[model samples]
Target: MTPTVQSLDHLVLTVADLNVTLAFYTEVLGMRAERFTPADGSQRWALRFGSQKINLHQAGAEFLPKAARPTTGSADLCFLSDTPLADWQAHLDALKISPEEGPVRRSGAEGPILSLYLRDPDGTLIELSNRL
Candidate 1:
């Protein structure tokens, strides 16, 4: 019998600057930043949202045996938002982060959604969306 996979637990990201990435996720996207020391005695950082998280590893100072082809600006991730799309737009405006593209319609994991696109400090494309 084959085993079935469950939901995502976390994702690892190699960032050019840890502080800049942390600031963008926490300040702009409103995620929680956490620090941890793994068994290897290496310091690690992550941004938590609800039940999911994205681990951060500095580009030049990554853990041994990382992704085979880890590079900055390589990730494109989408996040679901509970708030209204208009509110999200306003928040982005107040923060002065321009939207690369969106409030466009897009198909999500569950159903149809309205998505707003932007880039993080590392040039990773981020999509913020709300269910339609």
Candidate 2:
């Protein structure tokens, strides 16, 4: 028997402000919004990040409790960069997105990679990595 295998399609996050989340995903993270359906009559919204499409729906309060917030950490979303750390760091700086400082060296990642950690609008941790 073979186990099921699938690539990550998209991650849906419950956001307080849809515009803010969209801005952060596009302006800050460099993802383009492929399409957007106004919340007038629909209950689902679709956003494109590269080739991936994320579905966003209005969630009720109490979805993310204080106790569950920290435990979720910042690994919910990840993106790989062709540029190295120096260039990526400058990109983040240009956007005024100050990421938490962590180790900077070659590690056994997908390859010789540099990793940086940052948080999204909804407090979701995002990993930006580059392969050497």
Score every model by TM-score.
0.96, 0.70
Supply the global lDDT for candidate 1.
Answer: 0.92
Give per-residue lDDT, candidate 2, residue 111: 60
Candidate No. with top lDDT = 1
The candidate scoring highest on TM-score is: 1
Local distance difference test, per candidate?
Answer: 0.92, 0.65
Candidate 1 per-residue lDDT over residues 18-116, each given as its tens digit: 999999999999999999888998888999999998999899777877898888889999999998878888999999989999899999998999999
lDDT (Cα, 0-100) at 52 in candidate 2: 84
User: Model 2 RMSD to the real structure?
Assistant: 4.9
Q: Please state the error at residue 29 of candidate 1 in Å.
A: 0.4
For model 1, state the Cα shift of residue 96 in Å.
1.2
